[model samples]
Target: MVIVLKNQLRIVKKNIRQFIENITSLFSSKISDLLLAILLIPYLISKVGIENYGRYVFALSLTLFLVNIINYGFDLSAVRELAKNRHKPKMLKKLLNKVLSVKLYLTILMLVILFVVVFTIPLLRVEKTMYFFALFLIIGDLFSLRWFFMGIEKMKYIPIINVGSKLLYVFLVIIFIKQSEDYEIIILLEGIGLFIVNIFSFLYIVRKKRIRIKLISFYKVKCPVLK
Candidate 1:
């Protein structure tokens, strides 16, 4: 009986330690992101010139707005749902599929809207290429299943994967952007980095957690299953 009690205590301590580590990882990731942004922004503005940098920022802002719409508060709501139903593997898997499918549909709709908005406006139409590159950001965000890690309460991978991806973007900009003409590469690099890292994260989750992701049909996704 005493041995059983000792084992339980050890398990509790391990869980607490892991929880603290995950929290620290999250904090560090945020700090790294800020630092990277600070380091990259001035360099980009100097290399690409203010006007081009402004264009990239403008395109990014529009893409970000659409990205958030597609996200649809799933980061909060889906995480809560997953946490509540985590013990039931079958239900959790179904919920994950539904959430992803719904987001996919939203993303397609937003893409169509973005295309129309970008082309109809003269200012946006003039810089359509830059806007085209910015579309990568939305694609990256769509594949980034950060909520899954948060829901499962195994957040150690989040910092590593995200920071690495952002660092890659910074590296690419520094290496490739030598003049004002290279400005378009900035957003393109960022999008590429984001997409690669999130893909890796998704694969890691599937392999390590043994979670299969079979997206549900649109009909099922549109059902009131996910609120």
Candidate 2:
């Protein structure tokens, strides 16, 4: 009886530790995102000028819309799958890979569609180039390593990477804005920053967590579809 009680207590303690770690990591990452957003708004507005800033914002809005269309709610679904099969690392990996594969294919299709729309729509013609390039941001957000962290519930590293990347981006933006007032430069910076951050985080997860998609391992499962 005492042994059983001790084992339960130990398990509880471990869970609590993990919970605290995840929370702390999330907090750190959010703080970084908050700071970056705050700094980016002023820097972007000031560097690009009000008129160009509005155009940039419009392009960004379009990019986000396309990103959502491409994502088709797979991000949340992947996380849920991971949570459901937390005990089975192999299963989680399979699920994650399948979802990722689907997302990648969808993203490519969306990009092509968006490219067509950007060229065909008269109103979007002026900002077409910018919007096209903005696809990188959408891809970055979709493939963000943060999703994997959320799935595995080992979120401590996410915030660290997220925050560090945002800070580095902010620094780069400052340097660029100091030298020029080109709105395209600012927009490019934003897209590139997001790409770099996501890539870095994804690489970190792959290297440290050994998260990978094995095409043969994935089995058909009714994954919860999120809207």
Candidate 3:
């Protein structure tokens, strides 16, 4: 019985180590992202000039607003669901699919509304492409699946992937942006880089056993209205 107890204690310690590691990965990713943002902003402003840069910022804000609408509280909610139902991979897979589908529908609807608002507003209409490209940031988020990794306590090392992608974005900007006309590249980089990292995160789940994905009936889920 003492041997049994010793084995169990070791298992518990290993689990604790993994959980702490996951949390550390999350904080490290956040800090790196913050630092990257700080470093990139000045170079971007210098390249685009104040006026164009200001316009880009405005466009990002609008896109961010729409992104939040699509995400809503799914991060917390899905994490809760996973935490409760974890251990049952089959069930967790269904819930993940349902949540992703619901998010996709919301994203499409929100995009439609965003376009309508952008086109209808005479002032915003001029920068419609910029606003629309920024939408890719959110679209890329579809693949992030952060809640999945968080719930699983795997974290999947976002800091490494995110920082790598951001560095590429920085490189692209430095090489391409010599004038105001190149300002559009900024949005493009955001879109492309976000997708790259998010795709990396998603594949980490799908390819490895880090997490599982399965098809499930949407009707089984009582998804909130943009469902």
Candidate 4:
């Protein structure tokens, strides 16, 4: 009886360790992301000045609004699949392909509509049209990569990449912008920074996981039956 109890305790301890590791990984990732945002905002404001910063914020808000329209709650579906089949490559690939296909199409459509709005809408006071273009790409790429990571349960990488990118942006901002008047350039720099970082990270994941970008043939992959 004592031997059996000792074995049970060992099992419980092992489980506890695994749980702790998962939680720690997630916590570290989230903390890094929050820190990046906190640092980037001040750097942006200082470099861009108040008026330009306000314009940047408005552009970002509009980008977010458009992203939400394309997403249509598909993020939740990806998360559910990732949780259920983290270890199954085939399942993960299928779900990811489906989600990516839908997102890609939606993103293209949104870009077209946004291009018209930015061009026609006089209220969007965006001086550099390239800045809006960069903003759209950055937001779309980041959002898609986020869903991919969440599904795979490899979220530890997200914060590291996000924070590292922001840090690089800070360095670039200081190096390039000597005057506060260069707000348009600085804003464009910020967007370009995010775009480059996300692209690198996304490529890394694809290479590491050997994920092939194939067209999803079937409309539906069997999802896990929840209890």
> Highest TM-score: which candidate?
1
lDDT minimum window of 10 residues, candidate 4: 218-227
Q: Residue 81 in model 4: shift from native, Å?
A: 1.2
Which prediction has the highest lDDT against the true structure? 1
User: What residue pairs clash in candidate 4, if any at all?
Assistant: none
User: Estimated TM-score per prediction?
Assistant: 0.89, 0.82, 0.86, 0.76
lDDT of each: 0.84, 0.71, 0.77, 0.68
Model 1, poorest ten-residue lDDT window? Answer: 218-227
Tens digit of lDDT per residue, candidate 1, span 28-131?
88998899889889999999899999988888888988998888678788888888987888877787778878888888888899889989999899888877
Task: Give lDDT: candidate 1, residue 209.
Answer: 60
Per-residue alpha-carbon lDDT of candidate 4 for residues 42-82, written as tens digits (9 for 90 to 100): 87677667787787677767776777876766668667767
Candidate 4 yields a Cα-based lDDT of 0.68
* Residue 111 C-alpha lDDT in model 2: 84
Kindly report which residue stretches of model 1 are placed more than 4 angstroms away from their true locations once superposed. Answer: 1-18, 223-227
Arrange candidates by lDDT, highest first: which order? 1, 3, 2, 4
Model 3 spans > 4 angstroms off: 4-8, 209-222, 225-227
Over 90-192, each residue of candidate 2 has an lDDT whose tens digit, in order, gives 7766666676666666677778887898889888877666776677677777566566678778787787767665676677778877622466555566767
User: After TM-score superposition, what is the CA distance of residue 211 in candidate 1 from its true location, in Å?
Assistant: 3.6
Tell me each candidate's RMSD, in Å, in order.
Answer: 2.3, 3.5, 2.9, 4.2
Pairs with backbone N, CA or C atoms under 3 Å apart (clashes), candidate 1:
none
Q: What does the lDDT read for residue 107 in candidate 3?
A: 75
* Residues 1-227 of candidate 3: C-alpha lDDT, one tens digit per residue: 99999999999999999988987898888898899889988888887898999888887887778888877787787788787877887766676777777777777788888889989999999887777677778788777777776777667566777777788778778887898877766787787877888887778666764445554445644446223
